[model samples]
Target: MEVKIRNRSRVMQVLALAMFLSLVWAYAQLEWGVPHTVKRNVLQSRGSILASDGSVLARSVGGQRVYPQGVLAGQVVGMMGETDGLEGLEAAYNRSLQAGENLKLTIDPKTQAAAEAALAQGVKEHHGEYGSVVIIETLTGRVLAAASYPPFDPNNWRNYSAETRRNRPFLDTYEPGSTIKGLIVAAALNEGLTTPTTTYSTPMERYVGGRWGSTIHDAVPHPPTLTTKEILRYSSNVGMSHVVENFAADKERAYLSNYGFGQDVQIPVVATATGRLQRPSEWTDLVRVTSAFGQGMSSTTLQLAAAYNTLANDGLYVSPRLVEGTPAGERREVIRPESARTIRGLLQAVIAEGISNAAGLKGYALAGKTGTSQVAVNGKYSDSLFDSVFAGFFPADAPRVTIAVTVHGATTNYHGSMLAAPIYKKIAASVISNWAAAPQQLPKP
Candidate 1:
C-alpha cells in the first residue's frame, strides 16, 4: 500500500510540472505577438530613398528600416514607421515606397553633407538655438540640399523633440527680415517704377504713412539720399519705403502672390507652408511700409530660396523638385528677365561691397541679401531676440545654384551678416566645389 501511495504522489508531481510548462509556453507566445503587432500590419516590403548620385540615404535591411547616412538630411529624408513613413519625403511618397518602388531624390548627397556640416558648425560656433540652410539648382529647381541645424538622428528619432525633427526649410516661417527686401526691390524694378540707379532721399528714421510714432529705421546709418542699388546694398528700410511709394498695396500683394507667397508648395515631400502675409484689404500704411522691409510678413526658407531662384532663372519661377524624375512644373514669367538681371546685379553689389560682403567667395560672384529681424514674442516684437538670414545665388552673371540660410534665436552675433553670412559662404563654397568642374570667373561689379 505504501509503494502505491508513493507512485501516485510522483505521478501528481510530474503532471503539475507539465501544466506549468504549458502555461509558460502560452504566455511567451502572447508576449511575442504583442511586440510584433505593429510590424505584422505591414503587408509589403518598404522602398528606399537615394541621392541623385545613388548614395543611400535611407533603406531597409533585414526587415529593419535604417538611415545609413545617419543624421545627414534627417529632417529632409524623414523616418519610417513599421507600416509607413512618418515625415518629409518618406511621408510624401509613402504609397509609392510601400509598393516596392525605389525613390531617387534630387538631393545631391555630397552637397547635402556639406550643407549639414556647415550648418552644424555655424549653429555651434555662433551659439545659435537653431539654423536652416537650403540649396536649389537654379534652372531645374531641383533641391540639392535642405538642411536644418541641430540635426537629429532618425535612427533614434524618439530621443529628439519635434523641433529638432522639424523640416525648417519647408515648414518653419519667420519674418524674413531684410531678405524680403530683394523681392520688394525686384517688384519695384519689374514695374519699371525705379531704376537700379534711381535715387531716393532716405532718412535714418521716417514715420510710416506719415503716422507719428509709427517709425521705420535703417540698420546702418545711410546718407540723406541714396540710389535704388544703394538701398539694397545697405538693406535700408527707409529707402525701401521710398522705393515702394509707386506700388499700390494691391499691386504689391499681387507681386508677392505671384512669387509663390501665401501658397503651399507641393514637392515630392509633404511640405506645406505658404507662409503668412496680410491680405490686400488688410494692408494699412504701416503694414505696407513694414512689409517693404521684410516685416509684417513671414516666409519659409524654401519660399525665400524659390524667390531667389527667380533671379537665378532670369525671372521664371520654377517649383522646387525633390524626386529626380518628377516633371518640371509650369514656369511663369513673374518678373522681366531684364528686371531679374538688374536685381541680381544689385544683390551682387550687396556681397561685393554691402553688408553681405562676408558671404563673397573668392573668384566667384556671390549675390545675396542679409536680413535681421526682431523676433515677435506673444504678438509683440522681442527686445533682444532676433532671426538673421542670408539668401543669394552664386556666379551672378551665370547662376548655377541658389542658397538661403536662416539662423534663429541668435542672442549675440544676431545680424544676418554677423551670423548667417559666414554660414552661407561655407555652404556656397562647398556646393560650388562639388557641382562645378571648373569654376567660372565672375567679373567685378
Candidate 2:
C-alpha cells in the first residue's frame, strides 16, 4: 500500500515538472510583434552620451541611449526617429552613442556653449530666418559644435519636417561668396601667381562675354590700385577676377579640389552633398571671375570650412572628419609654405584690419574672410536676401581651431561683418582664453 502511494506522488511530481518546463519554453518562444516569437519593445530601449572631460552630455532617463539634450543638440548629435532612422551624431555613431561605448568628440563643449550663446543673441538681434555656427579642432578634424538656427528639437523630431530636421552644416550647399577669396589669395601665392606685394587696378565691371559679365565692387566701392593684401582686405572683385583670368586652370582646379570643394563629407551621415566644383574645362570666363569671388559655384558649409581650414593650416588641406575608426581623408598639398604665409597675413587683415576688422579679439591674432552672397530666386541673385558668412581661425600664427559662422538673413544689414564677425569675436574670445594649453604668443605676419 505504501509503495503504491509513493509511486503515485512521484508520478504527479513528474507531471508537474513537465508542465512547468512546457510553460517556460512557451514563454521563451512567445512572439513579439510576430506570431509565435518573443520580442522586446524598442520604446523600452535607452542610450548614453559623454563629453570629452567625462561629463554626461545626455543619457537615457531609464538607463538607455536617449535624447537628453532635448532640441539643442545640432545635426552632428543627430535625431531619434519614430521609426528609428538615426539622424546626426546619433545616427552617425549609433553603436557608440547607444552601445555603452565611450566616445571623445573633437569638440569643446565650452566653446560650443559660447558659440551657441552668441548665435542665440544674433538670431534675436537680427530676427534672422536661419543660422548655423561651427567650431572645429584643426589638428583632429573633429567638429566641436555645428548648429543652425530655428533648431528642431531632437525629442520631437517627428513634429518637424525632414527639411527642418536635416543637418544643414554638413548637408546643405550654397554659393560661398567672398569667403573663398581668402583661399584664392592663398592658392595664387602658393602657385606663384604673385606675392602679397602684387596689385591690380579695378573697374566697376569686366565682361567675359555679352551676357556673362564679372563685377568688382566692395560692400560699397574702394581704392582701384589694390595690392593683393588690399584686394583681400577690401575684397576686390577685379583683383580676384584677374587671378582666375591669369592663372592656369588646371592648377586652380587642383587647388580647389585640395581645398575640399565639390567633395562629400565623411561623417557617416546620409544625404551629404558634394558641392559643385566645375572643372577648368567646363568654365566660362564669367564663371571663372565669379568663382574667383566665390559665386557661380556651390558648396556645403563643411566644404567651406575645409577651404578656410586649409588656409589656416598653411595651404595643407586636411580632411574634415566627424566619425571614429579609419580616417580615409588626407592632407593634400595645395600651396607653397610662403604663399600660405602671405595669404594668412592678408586674411588676418580681414579680422585684424580689413573689412571684418571689427571682428577681432583683443589679445588674439585671427584671420578670416567674409561672404555675403545674394540668395538665388528664379535662377537669379535675389535683390533682398543674402547668405552672410565668416570663416576664420585664431592666434593666426599657429591656428589650432577654425570656425565658420553664418546667418542666412540679417535684418539690420546683409553683410557678414555686422552679424557673423561679431559672433566669431564672442566665440573666439571665450574658446582661446579658456583653452588649457598655455597661451601662445600671437604669430608674426
Candidate 3:
C-alpha cells in the first residue's frame, strides 16, 4: 500500500510539472511574440511584389526569392537577402512583405521595358559607365518607369556590383547642367522678373562674378543679344547669368527649394538622396551665376523629373509616387498656372529650335532641355568626363508624360544632345506608339 501511494505521488508530480511548463511557454509567447523558427517559416512564404497589371515582379519559390521579370525594373523591385530584403522596394517594405502581404507598384511593364531598352542601348552605344531613366505620369506624378543600367538581374544579383544594383534615379546625384535652365527661366517668369521675350547681352564668354570672378561661356555660338527663349534654345550660360543677376540670392534659393531641390523625395526606396543645394547665405556671386545655368548644385534623376512635372502639371507639385494606394505627397503650387503654360511654350520652342531639337518626335509635340555637365574629379571638374542629361514632357499642348534621362561618364559622344536626347527620343517614341493616346500635331516653331 505504501509503494502504491508513492507511485501515485510521482504521477501527480509529473502532471504538475507538465502543466507548469505549458503555462511558462504560453507566457513567453504572449510577452515576446512568435519564436524565430516559426517566424522564419513565415518568411519562407514571403509575399509577392506585383505591377499594377497584376504581373509578379518578385516572389518566393522553393524557399528562394525569384524575380520573374528578370532584369526589367530590377533596381526598383529589388531582391532579397538570406532572410530579409537587400534593396529597392524589397528593403523598403520588408516587414509587410515578410508577413505575406503583397506590395503593388504603379509601374507599367510596357513603359518600363521601353525605358530599359532605350537606356541600355544608349549607355552601351555611348560607352557610358552607367545611366538611369525615369518616366512619371504628368497629372498624378505616378512613376511609370524607373530604369537603371548596366542592367541588374536579381536572380543573379550576386554577379553584379553594388553600383550596378543601385537605383540611380533615386540615389545618384549629379550637376544637372543646362536642364535646370528651363526651371530657372520658369522661376523668372513666376516672379515677374522676366518674360520669354526679355533680352540680355549674351556674349559667348563673359566674367560673371564682376571682372575678377570666374567666366561662364555659351556652348553654342549666337549673336550678341538673346531673348529668354533664345537663351534656353542656345543653352547660353551667359544669358542665364543676366536673367538671374537682379534676382536676389535668397529668392533664387527659395525658388530652387520650391522646385523640390535639397528636399527628401520620400519614396518607398531603401535609401534616397536629397541632392545638395547650398543655403542662400552660401551663395557667392560665382555660385549664383553657375547655379543659374545648372552648376554648383546637384539633383537626382527622379528629382529632375519631378521638377519638370511641375510645369507639366500646370504648376502643381504632385509628389512622385511609386507604390499604388500610398498617400499622395506634397501637392502645392510652385508657380502660377499662366507661368507654367508660358514655360511649357518656351520648352516647346526648345525642341523645335534649340540644341534639344534631336529629342523631337516626328508626330508628337515634345518639350525638353538638354544638359551636359562636367563631372568633378577630386576637387576640380574633369575635362574628359561628362554627365549627359535630358528632361522633357510630351504632347506639349497638354502634356501627359514627363521623362528624365542621365548617362554618367560617357567616353564618346558625351553631349546631352547627342547621347541623352536620342535615348529620350526613343523612349518617348515607344511610349507614345505603344500605350499613349494618339499624339496631337507637332506645335509650330
Candidate 4:
C-alpha cells in the first residue's frame, strides 16, 4: 500500500511538471520564439512622420500606428492598413517606411494648422461641399501646407466618407474658370502676341465656332473695351477669348502643357491626378476659346498652384517636393522673366483695384486671381453648383510663397472673389505671420 501511494504521487508530480513546461513553451512562442512569418503577423512597427519643426504627425505607439494630433494632416499623411500603407504620403513612401525609415515632411506645422483652420471656416461659412488649400515655397518648390476639408481622423477612418479621405488638392480637378486667365495672359505676353496695355473690344458675351459651340460670357458686366491688364483684373471671359483668338490650337495646348497641365504632378504623395485637357486634335474654336478662360479643361489645385508658382519663381516651373530626399524638379523657364513680372504686376492690380480688391492686405502687396466654374455632373454641367477658386503669391514685390484655395459645390452665387479670395487672404495672412515672410523692399528692376 505504501509503494502504491508513492508511485501515484510521483506520477501526479510528473504530470504537473509537464503541464507547467507546456505553458512556458507557449509563452515563449508568443513572446519571442515564434517563426518570423508569425512574428510579422503579430508585430507591427512603423516609422514616424515628422513636420519640418520636428513635431510628430504620425508615429508608432505600443506597436500600433497613431496620429498624435488626430487630424493635423489627416488626408495628407494618409492611413495604413495592418501591414502596409493604403493612401497618401504613407502609400507614396510605403517601402521606405516599412523598412523603418523615418520621414520628415516639408510641411510647416503652424502653416498647416493655419491653412486647415481657415479652410474649414471658409468651407463651413460658404456651405461648400468640400475645400482644399495648397501652399508651396516659391523658390524651393517645397509643399508647406496641403489642407483638405471635412476634417478626418485616421484613427476612425471608417467613419469618414471617401470624399473626406481623398486628398482634394492632389486628386480633384475642375475647370479653373477665370483663375486660368492669368496663365493665358502670361502665355500671350510671353509670345509677344500682346502686351498688358493691348486693348480689345470687351463685349459681355461672344459666340464661338458654330451654333453647336457654346457662347462665352463674362461672370460680371465689363466695360465695352479694356486693356489686357484690365481684362485680367475684371476676370472677363470674352476679353480673354479675344486675347487668345489668334493663338493656334497647338500653341495654346503647348503653353498650357508647359504650365503643368495634362500630366500627373508627382509629389511625395501617392494620390495624384493628371487633370483632363483634351488633345489639340480635339480642340474646336469654342473649346480653345473657353480653355483660355478656364473651361473645357481641368486641373488639380496642386497643379494650378505649381503653375502659378512658376510666375512667382520668375517664370521658372519647379515641380513640388514633399519628401526630404527628393530634390526640387529641374527648372524650366516657361515664360520670359519680364513676362512673369508683367503678369505679377497685373495680378497685383487685381487685388488693388479689381473685383478682388477686398483680398488686399494693408502695407503689403498682394497678387492673385479668382475663379468660379460651373461643375459638370453626369456628363452635363450643373448651373446650381459651382467651384470657387483663388491662386496667388504673397508680398508681391518679393515672392516667397504661393497659395491656392478652392471651395467646391457652392450652392449660392459662387464667385471666387466672394467665396475663395477671402479664404486665401485669411490663410496668407497667417502664413505671412508664421514665417515672418514680409518683404523688406521691392527688387531692383
lDDT of 3 by residue, 1-445 (tens): 9999999999999999999999999889867776656656766779999997899999877666888899989998888876788888898899999889999999999999999999999999989999999999999999999999999999999999998899989999999999999999999899999999999988899887875589777888898999999999889999999999888888888888888989998675447799989977888888888898788899999999999999999999888999998888888899999999999999989987764457987667889999999999997999999999999998787899999999999999999999999999999889888865665565475
Candidate 3: where is the Cα deviation over 4 Å?
1-40, 268-270, 355-357
lDDT of 1 by residue, 189-236 (tens): 899888989888998988877653397777797789999999988888
Error of 4 at 338 (Å): 0.3
Give one digit per residue, the lDDT tens place, for model 2 in 126-146: 877777787777766777777
lDDT of 1: 0.85
lDDT of each: 0.85, 0.71, 0.89, 0.85
Q: What lDDT tens digits, residue by residue, belong to model 4 across residues 1-445?
A: 9999999999999999999999998888777655555535432556788998899988877666788878888998888876677778777888888778889989888888998999898888878899998999999999998899988888877888888999888889888888889998999999888898999998898887676787777767779999998898888888988899889888988889989989778664456889988987898888888889888899999999999999998999999988777765656889989999999999988887775445876657789999988899999989788999999997776699999999998776468998899888888788777767655543321
Better of 3 and 4 by lDDT: 3
Q: How much lDDT does candidate 2 score? A: 0.71
Worst window of 10 by summed lDDT in candidate 1? 35-44
lDDT of 4: 0.85
Cα deviation of 301 in candidate 2 (Å)? 1.5
Regarding TM-score, does 2 or 3 come out ahead?
A: 3
Clashing pairs in 3: none
User: Model 2: residues >4 Å from true position, as ranges?
Assistant: 1-47, 63-65, 82-85, 95-104, 209-218, 269-271, 324-328, 355-357, 436-445
The clash numbers for all candidates, in the given order, read 0, 17, 0, 0
Q: RMSD in angstroms, all models? A: 4.3, 5.8, 4.6, 4.7
10 residues in a row with least lDDT, candidate 2: 32-41
Worst-scoring 10-residue span by lDDT in model 4: 436-445
